[model samples]
Target: MVSTPLPPADEKAVWVRSMFDRIAPRYDRFNDLLSAGVHRRWRARTIDALAPTGGETFLDLCAGTMDLAVAISERAPGARVAAADFSIRMLASGREKAAATPGPVHPVAADALALPFPDAAFDGCTIGFGLRNLADYSQGLAEMQRVLAPGGRLVVLEFTTPPGKVFRALYHGYFHHVLPRAGALVSHDSAAARYLPESVKAFPDVRSLARLLREAGFDRVRYRYLTGGIAALHHGVRP
Candidate 1:
């Protein structure tokens, strides 16, 4: 199979949306298999950072399959979670799960860089394994900040390079080599699968992303590496 480079910045969002739509059918399952179900633990940690209480409104931006939204709903039971994503088919794939969640999970078609809601719309916000896919990380972070209420917490969970050299080398070997092939086999879209590692490679590191959150006007920024630094969970608050 031929390896395709990631789309240029001007065309990224459109290409990403279409790619996700094409892979929506196998996205969840492939994730489960590839990460050996550890992605769930990472997401659980993200929710821990968000610390949702009952009766709050939350936005799960770039929520491809509403995984975080449903998890938050299940955790708080009285929260209303909006699962916003630009890819309609990706959101559609999670409809059943959202419907069955304890709290209401509303799926909305929204661009991360241009969210449709008014300012201060949510009590908390989260983006899990999704923020890196945004065409403009700064703009996306700004939009997330804009919709959050004063003191609203923002939690971001994303793939990152490990700090340990040996672990990093081994992880990169599998991540860049094995995982893409497996993802392509499962999703039946080699380019989309290849985009996964390329996207992660192109994204900022954990500390760099924390600095970005601060630069985007979030206060009290903090981050912690997860699962041997394979991923990171970042927390910040809107002042």
Candidate 2:
């Protein structure tokens, strides 16, 4: 199913920020409800792909409530993980999760399109389910690449359209119809929750996204389908 065209770039960014702010308080909980907590499994795989060693500085763009940041600190205790998001409310929520992290995971209020970090400042970067919400997906990918040191890996975990006809049909129906309602029930906001499936439907397929990553100056771009392509983990190295 196709979604209506997105608004102008500036307008869409403002809308997405406000939408995330409105739901920040319960965002993590609603995520569990929507994915039945299986997102943790996908994220674990993403961390493994990231393979953060000691003393590296990494970023979690579109970090939301900082689940990945916390996990990164847990997995690589000496790594410095910074979670950056446009939503201040989401950053505030992320701060709470930092207390439990093994290493320091700082929250930064930053935009992905124009990241505040210097070029090649980070050892690695990860964007979890947040790339699709960007008004300009390709630009966002490039910006992530610009922030990473040459040869540093970039891992992106995101929602994707399933490739199989039978699975796609079933997943599409549940995503648009069931998932939104389930999210609304969890967060008490239907419209923002409804935007979830709309964004996913509008995102490019796995192959297209891989090509976009390569075009964005990332080499050796590859993707692995998760849960039958209901989501995917895409990885690349900065060149």
Candidate 3:
């Protein structure tokens, strides 16, 4: 059975920031455990699709703990990465991680709805595990498109429900039950953990999300499902 979307009440950006702040300390650890480290591979694939080379300017939105920021910097030594998140705690944690990385990573506190950058400021933008949390995914997508230079790319990595009947049943059980319990135990934020599954359930899946990207002024929207459609990496280009 398909899950109904959660109430729109919790979709506010302020609500999202508060929830993330409560789990900032253990967020990365929980992600590592929850995805069984497959998140790393997924991120690598997303970055590989972007093909960021030296001298490029990249933006990592909702960049909690700077995982994507550090990875992009390492992958492209000369690349300058600006990682932004609305949550101060998450941004602080990300800054701490960025400081230890060899390449340049700038952690900024910014809102996804109103990115504090000039139009066409970035050569590319990435949002890893962030889209589902946005109050207005379409607005967030538009903001990313606004910041990207013409011909620049945007890569989004987000969780989605699996397609197969048996797999969907198993995955839903894990997501709705096991994940929340495990995440709450690790992150010490029961509400945040509970919100995770609800948020993913509320988000548009691969095909619908790609259509949203196109509506947001991106061209050549495409997506690749991973882990039996549990997650997807979406790519789009600014024309």
Task: Kindly report which residue stretches of model 2 are placed more than 4 angstroms away from their true locations once superposed.
Answer: 1-6
Model 1: which residue pairs collide? none
lDDT of 2 at 103: 93
The candidate that achieves the highest TM-score relative to the unseen native structure: 1
Between 1 and 2, whose TM-score is larger?
A: 1
Ranked candidates (TM-score, high to low): 1, 2, 3
Tens-digit lDDT track of model 2 for 1-239: 33445557779999899888999999888888788999999999999999998799999999988999898999999999989999999888878778788899999999999999999999999999999989999999989999999998999999998889999999988998887777788888877877888788778888999999999999989999999989999999998
lDDT of 3 by residue, 1-239 (tens): 23334547555677788878888888889989998999999989988988999999999999988899899988998999999998889878767678877678998989998999999999999999998888788889999999999999999999998988999999999999898888879988877888888888878978999999999999999999988999999999999
Q: Write one digit per residue (lDDT tens) for candidate 1, span 50-153.
A: 99999999999999988999999999999999999999999999999999998899999988998999999999999998889898999999999999999999
Judged by whole-model lDDT over C-alpha atoms, candidate 3 comes out at: 0.89
Clashes of each: 0, 0, 0
Error of 3 at 176 (Å): 0.8
TM-score of every candidate:
0.98, 0.96, 0.95
How high a TM-score does candidate 1 get? 0.98
Q: What's the candidate order when arranged by decreasing lDDT?
A: 1, 2, 3
Candidate 3 global TM-score: 0.95
